[model samples]
Target: MKIKIYFRIIGLSVLFVLQSCEDFVDIDSPNFQMVTEDVYNKEKTTIAAIQGIYNQLYVANFSTYGVSVLGAMSADILLARTDTYLPFDQHELFSINTTDAGFNQNIWSSAYNMIYMVNRALEGLENANISDDLRQNLQGQILFTRAFTYFYLTNLYGDVPLLLTSDYDTNAIAPRNSKEEVWLQIESDLDEAAALLNKQTEYKDGERFYVNLSVVEAFRARVYLYRKDWSNAESFSSNVIARADLYGLEANPEDVFRANSKEAIWQITPDGVRNFAPEEATHFTLHVNGTGTTITGNTALSDDFLNSLVPLDKRRLWIGEVSSENEHSYFSKKYWFDNDGEIQQYSTVLRLAEQYLIRAEARAMQNKLAEAISDLDQIRARAGIDLITDSNPGINKQALLDTIMIARKRELFAEWGHRWFDLKRTGKVNTVFSSNPTWQNSDALYPIPGEERLKNPFLTQNDGYGN
Candidate 1:
């Protein structure tokens, strides 16, 4: 299913289902409620419910579908290419102004919408007559989804109102919790999800998009990494990496994300036919006319970083191009699908490469430099580059750490919103991002969307936006 158009459907459904009771009464049927109930009744419905969650990934609305993409856009890997035309830059959040209605509103709405559906699904499963095993699995999925949604919300908005229960009425006006409180809830939800989900099973097709025990663990590791709980982060990441045969470093760093290739530990993409191209157009300048005629300007990769890649590194080939035509700068080539002829493209959410990198970083932080080097070597070897074989091998801790982080930058360039978050986690936000260069610290987190803040007066605006 080309989930590209799903936001419109979801938006309409929300309007029809969430507007005044008169609209609900006017409807020929209870849309959200009936679908919620019907989906819970059957295994197929539950399966579809999971698919519906993946649908959120491919949709275009930042609030309902496009938040991750938007987050990445504001980061370093990708550029908006089109000025004022793209909502991200036009509203100036990328540059830290934070008054953009389109940018903030989309993020707020998207997080809440996913939360709403996930809560509804959890409630549906609770009321369902499914077997305990089946119910547990469904619950696992719901728990992970809720945690995943809140992870995005809290990370972006800091202290957001925690909505653990599905009681829409009472939870509507709840006050914002502290960032620490929100992370606690996130940790709890992932723990429950990991316990319930079967880590042994491998889901095929769209089923892979849904959260599993491993996914929850990986995310928890990510959360811990964000919170700087390096030990727990290392532990969770190690557990996932122990299943290395199932989820190891991609054999070819290039093949790891060849649009349709399958080394993905987790990914959410639209059906190619009607969806976006291999990657979003915002990251790359497209030569659509086939004569190198520029169709759109892309967010160029940093020249200093691009030059740091070793000559033999395969990822450099995959990401950087030698274009002499349009101003001659390094542009991202990760999603260069010429045939698609449109903007929206398949976006990658998670990959095994990140797991390896995470494992390496976590281990190094734990002072396991040799072990960290092994992990880092796996990535470098796949990129056809030589391993770090220097005689001065006594763990130059900070240098090794820097190398691993730099490798992350090279490996995951434009894949997701890594640069900004990576910078934030490493305390490089101010150093890397000078005052309002592209976007600033006040722009650090997007403003609480105007509509959401209005609806819930308890919602506090993120810093730097109030002025």
Candidate 2:
């Protein structure tokens, strides 16, 4: 088990440091046949190895507030409150400061570091000395993590370099893979994770913090919906939706984001590292002077996004505001608490509402218009809005699809990169932002961080960018 122990140690490197880090940066190659590996002797240590990756996600630039902010800014949902965020909000990215700036640290570099941790843990698990159940749990967690990270990577930057192993020597110079190839790997990883996690009927320690079977199905449902595999998307989403004992829509709209809520299929506890409320509140909560001129925080909900919400919608209540003599600034309060010491809210990654949306869109695309409206009604019922079935029972498939997309924007805004990825995937970026001169066809994909290309010459920049 020398290999297991050695790889676990590499995971420590992933958690503690990742400056200019590419995938699996330290070791040239894992000497699989090396001497006695001892890290997996106890189940606790094995769990810890996987736990380290979760912690990495919490503190890592990409996970905490990075994806939400960058995605919101790039899309129409959020407007820049500070000068530093102007580039992202304007659909242009730059690196005037250094590679350590927001874009590189949050998306490119940190995501690769996240993948590295997952790869290390996956390799260690192959010959681990743990019990079968523990091994399965660990494997399920690692595989899901790899897929989750890659989901954002491929969506944010088209055709990323897919590195699945911890062999730095082979991966360092690797060229980018096609977007379709990366997606296939994502589906493959999720398929294996589903098999590994299938037997676990409950969450780890009765908390949704850890990945479980439902989480796997929920994520796969999302991936399938993105890929336009409407059949698989509807099926996987239905799997999660059927588990009523463990999940449901919180009757109260505000209660959905609270810790351990009934609606959460999977959530990351804000109980480590910084030990604060979820980054959703900490980052998106805004401060403004009682005047037209001043605002704080990196971003605030954009005028377009704010105007899009119906005035009486319950979901609109999630927006907090600071009003001035002439203007009012709005911010998202999904997490509800922003003070660093208060930990009431967990950063929600996956929830049942999203599955409903996914199912709705998938069913609509498959011409199951009535079933699609039924699914859409679940979320609307929670949001205290008029149900699609009641409002318009005869809505056409294309109109239902369009309506679900709008619901996704309203319901899932300021969460992950849902809106940003949605615009790109659905070919609506140009249509949505047609009036804004700053929006462009080329801005759909993020630039490959220049630092990454410097290290790996095979890497190329996205459209309308330079070295």
Best by TM-score: 2
What are the lDDT scores of the predictions, listed in order?
0.64, 0.77
Question: Model 2: per-residue lDDT, tens digit, 237-345?
Answer: 9999999999999887788887789999888852343356676776888776555566667678877788887787889878888866556788988876545575666
lDDT (tens digit, per residue) of candidate 1 on 38-69: 55666765655555566654553542224435
Candidate 2 error regions (>4 Å): 1-36, 95-102, 270-275, 289-294, 324-327, 338-340
Steric clashes per prediction: 13, 2
* lDDT of residue 198 for candidate 2: 67
Top candidate by lDDT: 2
Model 1 misplacement above 4 A: 1-35, 63-68, 85-99, 204-207, 258-262, 270-285, 288-295, 320-326, 338-346, 435-440
Ten-residue stretch with the least lDDT total in model 1: 1-10
- What does the lDDT come to for candidate 1? 0.64
